[model samples]
Target: MISHCVFIRFRPEISRARRDALFAEIDALRHTLIGIVAVYTGVNVSPEIGMDKGFAEGFIVDFDNAGSRDAYLMDPGHQKTGARLVAAAVGGGNGILVYDLDTGHCLVRQAR
Candidate 1:
């Protein structure tokens, strides 16, 4: 299994309604795309001050494997959705951070 995580710092001009609508579109992709195990989206709610670093929203996408994750990256629907996200993000693409983890067994040592 693979977990794809994305965090976003949205531009100040983007409204809450717009953000919700964008997430809705992303959530809809789960049904249309193959190999997607699940999709989770939410706002940051940490009580610790200065931890979020302005990244107010995020999402997690679970895929069956690396191939599935690769396919999702190439999907047209994802491309469109990603474009919208980039546009609304602060400093364009700089405002988004993505991390992917392979949850399956590993033989190699984990990177530092």
Candidate 2:
């Protein structure tokens, strides 16, 4: 299993409505892509100090395997979406942080 995590710090000028719309667009990809187990998106709401840096929004994409995650990364739909995300971010591509975790175990717990 693979967990694709992304943190985004959008430009200060971007309105809340626009940010919500972008998240909606990202959520829509679950239907178009293959091997996507789940999609989660939201804005950071933590009150803790200095934890988030400048990233205000984030998303997690669960995939069945590394191949599936890699395919999603190369898909044209993802490319388009990513381009839009980068355009709205603070420093173009530099404003986003991405991490992929290889879950050695199944993402879901098995029944006893």
Candidate 3:
């Protein structure tokens, strides 16, 4: 599995409603796309304070493989949403962070 992690620091001017709308748009992609294992989005709810810095909101998209993940990245619908996210981000683009990892066996439950 491929984990696509995206963290966002939205500008203060961006309303919660707008944020929710954006998240909803992303969630809707599963209906049109393939190989999306899962999608999760929410605000930071960590016990440790200040650890999140300014990135209060984020989303995770689990893909079946790199091919599916790449296809999603090149899709026009995703590009549109990405543009909106970048615009609403604190520093336009600097406020967003992305990381993709190949979970491989790490995601498996080993018998201890």
Candidate 4:
């Protein structure tokens, strides 16, 4: 299995209420998309101490393999969720980082 992770930073103008709504929408994708083995999302709790950049939200999705990850990229529900994320939560430029996990070595490396 491969863990597909994405960290998202919301726009400065976006309100906390809007961000919560976006989080809800993202959580729904787990039920909508078929290829996802598991999905998890959360807000950054320790922005002041841990990260200087104030990244807002993040997602961790487990897939059976690389092919499932590719399929998820093209899935309509996933695409719709992304559009909603951009329109409702992140109004300005968004920050994202993706990674792939190797369960055997317990290591995560940036996905190409």
Candidate 5:
């Protein structure tokens, strides 16, 4: 199995309504994309010190393998939905992070 984890930090100027809409749009992907075994997303509310709470929204998606992950990345629904969500949610370049689970290493990559 492969896990695609994403951390999204909202633009401080974004309204609550927009944030909620972004969350809803993200949730809608579960039904629109094939090869997604499971999808979970939510706001980060941890109180841990020095923790980058800048990342307010995040999601974890489980797939059968890397091929499924790649498909999800290129899926038309994902592209359309993601553009809408990011255009509304992100503030700048530092607002997102992505990680991929491998055999023993969690490879971090740019969230493009």
Candidate 6:
């Protein structure tokens, strides 16, 4: 599985409703796209100060594999959604960060 994480710094002028709508559009992709296992959206909730570095909201998409992820990237609907996100963000492209992790390396160990 591939975990696609995107951190976003929304512009102050962007309304909460817009943010919600954007995330909604993102989540809606799962229905039309193939190989999307799950989609999770959230705001930074950690108590540690400054840890998020002003990136308060974001979403994670779990894809069955890298191919699925790449396909989504090229999807026209996603391109439009990404353009909307970039426009609403603080510094256009700079306001977003994307990271992908392979689940194969993730090891879960039970407590001793």
Among these predictions, the greatest lDDT belongs to: 6
Give one digit per residue, the lDDT tens place, for model 6 in 1-112.
9999999999999999999999999999999999999999989999998999999999999999999999999999889999999999999999999999999678979899
Query: Which residue pairs overlap in candidate 1's backbone?
Result: none
TM-score of each: 0.90, 0.87, 0.93, 0.68, 0.75, 0.95
lDDT of 5: 0.74
Worst 10 residues of 3 by lDDT: 101-110
Any runs in candidate 3 off by more than 4 Å, and if so which?
Answer: 105-112
Candidate 1: worst 10 consecutive residues by lDDT? 101-110
lDDT of 3 by residue, 33-86 (tens): 899999999999998899988898999999999999999999999999999999
Clashes of each: 0, 0, 0, 0, 0, 0
Ranking by TM-score: 6, 3, 1, 2, 5, 4
Order the candidates by lDDT, highest first — what do you get? 6, 3, 1, 2, 5, 4
lDDT of 4 by residue, 1-112 (tens): 7788777767777787876776676667667666678878787677387572655577788877778778888888777777766564343335666678855466568899
Q: Ten-residue segment with the worst summed lDDT in candidate 2?
A: 101-110
lDDT, candidates in the order shown: 0.92, 0.89, 0.94, 0.70, 0.74, 0.96
For all predictions, the C-alpha RMSD in Å is 3.9, 3.4, 1.9, 5.4, 6.5, 1.1
lDDT, residue 55, model 2: 86
Residue lDDT tens for model 2, 1-112: 8999999999999888988888788788889888899988998889986699988798999999999899999988889889989999999989999989888664777899
- For candidate 5, the per-residue lDDT at 66 reads 86
- Candidate 1 Cα deviation (angstroms), residue 69: 0.6
Q: Please name the candidate that would achieve the greatest TM-score relative to the true structure.
A: 6
Better of 2 and 5 by TM-score: 2
